[model samples]
Target chain A: MNLKTLRDYGRVIFYAAEMALRSNLTDSFVLFGILVQPIIIALLAFWMLGDRGGEYIIFVVIGSGMTGLWTSCLFISGNSITQERWTGTLELMVSTPTPVSVIVIGKILSNVLQSLASMVLSYTLAIVIFGYVPTINQPVLFTISLLLTILSYACFGLLISPVFVLNPDVQRLQNGLEFPVYVLCGFMFPIALLPGWTTPLSYILSPYWAARALHATSSQWNGLGEVALSWAAMVALSLIYLMLSSLLFKRLLRRARLDATLNIQ
Target chain B: MKAIEVRNLRRVFRATIGVVRRKIKEIVAVDDISFEVYDGELFGLLGPNGAGKTTTVKMLTTMLIPTSGEARVLGLDVVRSAEALRSRIGFVFGGERGLYWRLSGYDNLRYFASLYHVDPAVSRKRIPYLLDLVGLSDRGQEKVEGYSRGMKQRLHIARTLLHDPQVLFLDEPTIGLDPVGARELRQVVRNLQAEKKTILLTTHYMFEADALCQRIAVIDKGRIIALDTPEGLKTYVKDLAVIEFEVYGVPSNVLEQLRAQPYVHTVSVENRDQKQALLIHSPRGSQAVPDLLSMMNGIRIGNVIVREPTLEDAYVRLVGGEA
Candidate 1:
């Protein structure tokens, strides 16, 4: 990247990091809600399936980490929108010359980092405590899976904030999302374990694809051809989520309670 | 060319009601309005709550697209050239929510500077200069959340000017500040003017508008009812006469007679303990004040104060008064 691009990305990254640090630095217990719970799930998996199950536990841990990051992005729409809707910060930010992209990117970037932190920490803890390790035949897909997982979750979460702008009650809509996501993504168990009727629904959710991809890395997920399909399915899901959310997000913002969204100075 | 040009700008928002199925209702937030601010001059868009001040600012600053009409800031069309316009102006909101509560005043300035594409080294030097200009140099290292309302306001002023934009739009810059803080903030605005930065500001404070605005447009019910220099606009309330007196209980009959007096045109009993305010106006000037004071007997009065029509009086007259 050129100097200008480097500076742009640097500024965006710093803003994201600063937002995370300022908002969450003092709240240590948030780990219980986001991090420790995922770790505990991994431990529970180890307990259930013994050494064979450790791989599933690691998959759950990473998937949950992805969820934390994605959820924050999703959370930003309701959290920041409802907040700016209440406090006037949203209006203030929007009214100024700050690039709309900057604000959107800033929210996503911060969510991504915070989510990444949650993921890395849980994975580290799982490594130290549960002794979870991956089969290393192909590291590229593993890296790509995590990156794509982050991309898919963040973009989907990023799109829904404008709903909160139009309705204060929309923030509560997020709760309905968590249980359905956890169940459908098969994070708690294996996708094969879910009822046959729910299979189509799981296929559409990005996390379902993410959970399966990361799980394949550990469970030996059948063979190369099967693993490639999982990877391809995730890529398709990411694109679909990315495109759909951007369109929905733009439409919602265009129709956003522009007056109500004024965040106070 | 005008630094800012607006042509019949408008924005319509839909309001919704109910729960199971919401009913969408249309609210015309910004009605048709148009005015241009000159280059290197301070203009004020003075208004009360819901007067479309914020919406107008949003349209001018290129945040909300005008549902109709057109606005060009520094010659760039608001909708088409929004990104370019962002670099051309600075905005300082009157509230304390935008700045990072955790970062020091300097850090906040530096952060915004980065967004405006200011070079890092230049920003390092520029931030301290801005902090010093707003008289927050000593407290540059202080976290924004810890700063008093006054200090936070000063930092906001510094933050807005960090990019050194050619134009500045300030929304109620001194909204809740105390007397001293408000005065200092106005002075900073004056300095910005001296440096030739065009300012389009909005405020409810009449005195602030009088002090800083070379020209002001007072918006009410989504319309610009009055637009002129503060002194010129005060003339609109020439019929409003303010006379204060410290009286030891004036009889009702005597007060009623004073109200009927020919030269004593308008009268109002405003609430003040031991002090009665009789707003006396006449087509004839201060000539009526002496005659009215002489007519008052059986009442011990202290200092029948007659004051010239103020901008507050003009604003009240122009905007109208009611509960």
Candidate 2:
């Protein structure tokens, strides 16, 4: 792309991010989802862990953070297009010169930012209120793992958004996927403990690799090489999802225009 | 060069109904319709609900691909070159559905301006200018949710103008606005016309179409049955006069009886404050007034008058009823 085109895309992303932030800031309900839900989940997990919680406080914190991220991905990013469809802005955005994918990326980025904030809040709450702070053996690796995981989740959200737009009833799938994903990905525990048949499924889930890397880095159970491998796996999977989602988005848009279903319920 | 050209454009929608026993139904929204909008001309598409006027606009604006044939705006094909075409055209649909209600009016415009790729410096100046043009200068910073229907409509107009498009499409821009708000919006449209912009407007309001459009196309049932200048369209009813009268609680049978008359072309009824205002058209001119009054048959009738043909009369004659 030329400089002008790049500049235009940058502007589109900037404005979409601004809109996402402004709208979410005003919505008390969305704030509750981002801030309160993870804290509540962390508190309950800590109570359940009890004396065993000291050894796994970091796991609980990261697990709750990932849960918050998943929630934002499932509801915020997934429903972004649905919200726009209801507001009647979806058609307008499609008719514009900018590609809708770019606009959606901007929205995903904004939601990812909120998810990160939620993760941080969950960690702070565990440390300050629950009096549990796990030692970080590889802070740098953990940070990299966290960022890549967030990016991957954002892409995953983008992948699901177009599906929601084409079939609004699929939104119920968001609620259905939440707890199952936590269990399957081993967000609060080790995937090795799960059944052998579920190992393949965990390998395919980016969050499983993310949680593995985070847990290893915090407990020093794995070396730098192992953590690097986890990071590589998450990045590769994220790229695949990003590319696949882009293709899906284009196909969905073509179908919508041909079917004339963009404006209808 | 023509600003817009359409050839045999059509759109068919397939909708599924029923849960247990689903059935698919086909709705042909825009039939084989063709028309040209000249550069710098203000063209109006006049039609009633379900008449396919909005469907036609959607096709032209690249929101819906045509089922067959082709549409071009500013010499660029709408489907193939939609990305480039979109940059040069703007559209505003009637109602307050498109704006981000939580954001300030200015922020809404600013955001759309970016989507259209308007230069930052240009947007900085153009946004304020558009807000003022739509008479929302002082309320630019207020959240859109707090704005009234008319104010939201005006903001919609402002949003469309952010990119300085060559062509503008407005679909029923004054659908539910109060009289004063609708009039203000019409003035904004007039100002855009003064700037030599090619605009394709769709509205059910015949008077608004007559006052604004240089040429009007009356569409019904997915077809353009009549296309002409407002004055030329009015000529269709030149030989007939309209007898308008008010009555208390007129029945449908009475309207059916009036339609059965040989000289009577059409009868339209409007309800106002518990009274029905009837506009009866006939080739007999004022001579049909007495017959119309007599047909009332002891009904409480009040204030009858005869007037010359108007664009509305021509519309009723062409479209066959109220829009």
Chain B TM-score, all predictions listed? 0.83, 0.97
The best candidate in terms of TM-score: 2
Per-residue C-alpha lDDT of model 2 across residues B1-323, encoded as one tens digit per residue: 89999999988988899999999999998889999999999999998899999889998999888999899999999999988899899999998888899999999999999999899999999999999999999999999999999999999999999989999999999999999999999999999999999999999999999999999999999999999999999999999998889888888888899999999988888778889888888888778887777888978988988899899889988888664
Q: Which runs of model 2 end up more than 4 angstroms from their true locations?
A: A53-55
Q: Write the per-residue lDDT of candidate 2 for residues A169-244, one digit (tens) a residue.
A: 7777778987888888887777778889988988888888888887888763657788888888888988988898
Q: What is candidate 2's CAPRI-style docking category based on DockQ?
A: high
Q: Which stretches of model 1 miss by more than 4 angstroms?
A: A1-10, A28-30, A49-81, A84-87, A95-102, A116-140, A162-170, A257-265, B9-32, B47-51, B234-241, B246-278, B284-302, B320-323
Q: How many residue pairs clash in each candidate at the backbone level?
A: 12, 0
Q: Each model's DockQ?
A: 0.40, 0.87
Question: Which 10 consecutive positions of candidate 2 chain A have the poorest summed lDDT?
Answer: A50-59
lDDT of 1 by residue, B37-119 (tens): 99999999887788889888877776677888999999999888876787788777777677677778887787677666677
Q: Rate the local accuracy (lDDT) of all candidates.
A: 0.71, 0.87
Interface Cα RMSD for all candidates?
3.3, 0.8
